[model samples]
Target: MKWSRAVHHVEELARRCDTPSPVPMLPVTGLWVFGDLLGEPRDLDWAHVAVIVDLPVDDVPWLDIPRGGQHWAQAVRLREPLSCLWRSAAGPVWNHRIVRPALVWDSTDGVRESTLSALRDGLGHSVRLDAPTPSALQTQLDAELAVSLRSLRRQHRSYDDQRWRPGKLTPHADSLWRATDGYLDLLDAVNAPQ
Candidate 1:
């Protein structure tokens, strides 16, 4: 499938799952695509796509995607029941090779660190998620994400920097940015006087 098609598929799947759409789907990056593709023992087609949603730390849900070949398209009960829902699709395959797709949301510090550690244990690498806070951290994360996005756009648009190795950009950049925006919206919703 074309990259665009794959992105659309993932986006639609995510929507169907009732997960809020925060950003346009982008290619999952960072790891050496080849190593990640080959390292997993399972059939690429059957590789499970995991989705992590961030709720208030105290209110976080505990759910597990069932083992065995269960596609996200199938209706499955969330282990940790939540009011919100979401769906996602597998990454694209190229020349019979599997690519992985991921979705993330802005979380609190406790949630972010715990989730990052879990992902790292499972995927064998450190993963960063944007944890947008209403406090000072939000400003810092927003600036960092913006810089990363700008650099990524440049690399995607030009090969001018054969030497300019782009830093690993997360799939959730846009979503995190949106979540930050949502935080601001929440402030307005609560009618906090400026």
Candidate 2:
């Protein structure tokens, strides 16, 4: 269940299932695998596979997806894309999960590289999967993730409570809530360091 193995596992499954990888389409700047694969190698076991897309992910026109390997793709989906503006919501988790392991990235226009660069600046450092993990970096990241999970759990509970209240909800409220629940479960599962 190491990083490479997990990626190979999913990829092998995709191959066996004859699933083609996706191509980032118009309005979708790029795609990159993120998560345990980007964490420390020894701590890379038991990962929750996820990717980031530039555009609003749901609006991404998938030219192709690993259809045969739809289960994981559908389950975790993504944590959503990061924005270049530091003032915007969704700050870094302090690692390569923010931007590396590029899959369909085309920085010819510099958009992809710029956003990632901006993110690194925001975090005050760069975290790269290709490089060796700095001492205790994994521990620091785990603590960061723990804080994120705790905060999300609180928000999710509040969301659930609001769902049952006497009020008219948006047409996609239930579906959006379910997606958030699934994401929370995925985060909860792979929050470990080893």
Candidate 3:
């Protein structure tokens, strides 16, 4: 998957925002979130996330995961409203909302593998992240998650470079490339259109 590029884009944007840094971005190599954090079986969709940011436990938000939506699979609620505009090779994108920090678990060994194995065995998987756990488990989870995000970023960069060639534009290609360029331009032109 072209996950590395997406991870890189998110990391770059996060850096530009000047917010408190969480754990470094890594690829979704082999990790999973286990415990009360995952409310239901359906929440597994978020299991494939390429980036997981580890936030202070105290600072983590206790917001409800929106019902049946894929848009903000990893979003958290915050007390104060905050927004940012980012441009990528794609086009202009806006993030308008408050965000909270939380512990991120890489699904590599935790949820990803166990869940799939359960499915294959004709058993269903269900667990919540909030349940109490030992510090050792938490440490392992965080470490794996960090590694995964980094790997994802590298993979994404490779995919983007391979799929999109620069300086060789047909009319159709020009329009598509323009969208990506426009996104970057908008980010650079924040508070002023270029």
Candidate 4:
């Protein structure tokens, strides 16, 4: 989907927050728990949830902490930094409406299967992030995942260059549009140029 469509989906996702969901559906794939320590990967609890909908800009990372009743759908100008997940230090926190900010946004289905649980178990609590066998944790990623990851990386990079930027400022309807923006293809995304 284009920029406008992405925003529309974001709002739609927020309204559905009352509906229970395990893994993030379609466009919403990245979610995390807000814990005692802000930005600590170790503190992620399976209980906390919320997914990020990628925006057109990569340079500006935005975090929207819902007030009392506000939701992700209501979040304005969404961009989250690709780093440690954090809970808001101040105010009443909405459990699942917030997400970990990431620069390298990985929304592929394979990532959801592999790492989603690790986050649930609390990455820092169960797994030794700096342990020698850290590589062992990533053994699940296969060629298929690699292609999808590569494709998303390229799409993000393309946005980095204002020249190739594809998202429009206003709403543009395209039935063929997608949150992945035609980038999640297995072969084309892999072979496509950056």
Per lDDT, the best of the predicted structures is 2
After best superposition, candidate 1 residue 57: deviation in angstroms?
16
**Over the stretch 21-66, how does candidate 3's per-residue lDDT look in tens digits?**
2223311212222221223323222222122323221111111111
- Models 1 onward score TM values of 0.21, 0.31, 0.20, 0.23
lDDT agreement of model 4 with the native: 0.30
lDDT of 3 at 158: 47
Q: If ranked by TM-score, best first, what sequence of candidates would result? A: 2, 4, 1, 3
Question: How many steric overlaps does candidate 2 have?
Answer: 0
lDDT against the true structure, each candidate: 0.30, 0.36, 0.28, 0.30
Model 4 residue 140 lDDT?
17
Q: How accurate is candidate 3 locally (lDDT)?
A: 0.28
Off by over 4 Å in 4: 1-16, 20-72, 75-133, 140-149, 156-194
Shift in Å, residue 88, candidate 1:
16
Per-residue accuracy of model 2 over 24-66 as CA lDDT, tens digit each = 2322222343444444444244433223333332221112122
Q: Which ten residues in a row have the lowest lDDT in candidate 3?
A: 91-100
Error of 4 at 87 (Å): 17
Model 4, residue 1: what's the lDDT? 22
Error of 3 at 38 (Å): 10
Position 175, candidate 1: lDDT: 35
Ranking by lDDT: 2, 4, 1, 3
